[model samples]
Target: MADLVSELRQRASALGFDAFGIAAAEARPDLSEKLQAALAAGWHGDMDWMAETADRRASPVALWPEARSVIMIGVNYGPDSDPMAALARRSSGNISVYARNRDYHDIIKGRLKELAGLLSRRTGEAVKVFVDTAPVMEKPLAQAAGLGWQGKHTVLVSRQFGSWLFLGAIFTSAQLPASEPMAESCGSCRRCLDVCPTDAFPAPFQLDARRCLAYLNIEHKGPIPAEFRKAMGNRIYGCDDCLAVCPWNKFASETREAKLFAREDLREPPLSVLLALDDAGFRALFSGSPIKRIGHGRFLRNVLIAAGNSGDRALLEAVEARLEDEDALVRGAAVWAFAQLADGERVRRSAEAHAAGERDAEVRAEWAAVLPEVV
Candidate 1:
């Protein structure tokens, strides 16, 4: 069994997995209580799937009773430059480091499938693989498997990789030796919690998805709440404040996988360039990237919020152009962005021109909400 585990470790590294570990299928019996607490607190916000998949997500054995051991692996995706520096360039859009290239799910899932094949060939143990599309809780499972400890900010942090790991898991009926769990190493550091633009952390090791910009920008399907708009700044896709400020990152190096590196165009693309994208243009530009999944309406809405926060009057023309957008979400965000950049009179005038014809109650409400402020 020990020799078999050693062989699996070598194969994982050869396949480009940066971290490898194993855990019993039922190693963490406490997962159900923790997941239930988060759901009870309503911290997951609009991601209803978390609640829906709670039973299966409790542990590997719960997900599949035939599972006897689990394998966890990580691929480091450290950025070539400080992700925070992009925030100072207000006129440019800032994307999360992970999404700046091809969708990682596509990249990692193929590798996971190949590795699983190797395991099945060796032991004839039935294998199942996951690259985050399922109910299995990869982060906690990775901690159980000793890849790294889950940090205070609720992301995995490795001594070798810091907070920049893309994780995957393989489950099998083989009773592989479980690795020792890594202890929590954050100590007294509060940088991740303090740096959040929207106070996403309710307490140490606790996250409120409702207040997280990443969730709002990426997962939430409606108009962004007014309070979070300015806080969002120029980040059109996801927020990286907590992940980049980790002290453990001092040991982190840029990724070895070329596919995981940031694309120059996506690293800090100009907001003006983003605003000019029609649906076709948006799709073509982000063809293989994860940003394409948000669709054009949500993309435009995020860009408009960034434009409003930009304080660059140059974006006013583009902000105004979105007022006629067919999607109510896009039109409403344009209203807010226009209010942010244009003078009071132009805001009132634009409101008068468009408010009457706005059939969507949400868009009309957006116009109504801003009217009183100008007067």
Candidate 2:
């Protein structure tokens, strides 16, 4: 079993995974408790799937009853430059580093399937592969498999890769030797806690996903709450403030995967350009990227929120162009953006003109809400 585990690690490394380990396929009681507590506290926000699949996500055995061993893998997607630098460019939409390139699910899943096939051929064991698509609890499994300890921000932080890892897993009937779990080495670091633009962390190792910028920009389907809009700044797609401030990142290495490298265009896309994208144009721009999943309407809603926070008067025209946008979400965001950039009289004038003709109650409410603020 030990010899097989050693060979598995070597093969996984050869396949381009930065870290690898084996964990016993058993119930994780601690994970079950934590998940239940998170759900009870309503910390998961609109991601109801987390609550729906709680049992399946808690234990590997529950997910795959016949599986005897789990192989957890990590692919480092660390950025070559400071991701936080884009935050200062208020006129540009700051896309999170992970989404600035190809979709990791596509990249990591292919690699995992290839490695699983190789393992099955050698060991004659049946195998199944998963990336982020499934509720397999990869983080805790990765920690149990000795990949890294979960950091204070609740993201896996590796000594070799920091918070820049993309995780995947393979479940098999092979009874491989389990690796020793990594110890939590965070010590007294509070950098990740302090750096959050929105106070997403309720406590150490606890996150309220509802307040998280990443959740608001990505998973959220409606208009962004007015409370978080200012703090969100120019972050359009996802937020990286918490991850970028981790001290462990000093040891992080750039990803060797060519497809994971940050695209120059996406690193800090101009708000003006992103705001102008029609549905067809948006599809062409994102193409194979993960950003395409949100579709053009939600993407534009995020872009308008950034425009409101940009404090750039030049974006006024772009924001105004979206006032009559077919999507009520987009139109609502445009009303808010107009208030942020235009003077009191200008905003009132525009609101009066649009509110009379606006049929959507949500968009009308946005105009009404912003009118008093500007006045």
Model number with the top TM-score: 1
Q: What are the candidates' C-alpha RMSDs?
A: 1.4, 1.7
Candidate 2 lDDT, 328-357, residue by residue in tens: 999999999988999988988897788888
Candidate 2, residue 179: lDDT: 88
Regions of candidate 1 where Cα sits further than 4 Å from its true position: 254-259, 373-375
Number of the predicted model whose lDDT against the real structure is largest: 1
Off by over 4 Å in 2: 254-259, 372-375
Residue pairs in collision within model 1 = none
How well is each residue in 74-115 modelled by candidate 1, as lDDT tens digits? 998889889999999999999999999999999889989999
TM-scores across all candidates? 0.97, 0.97
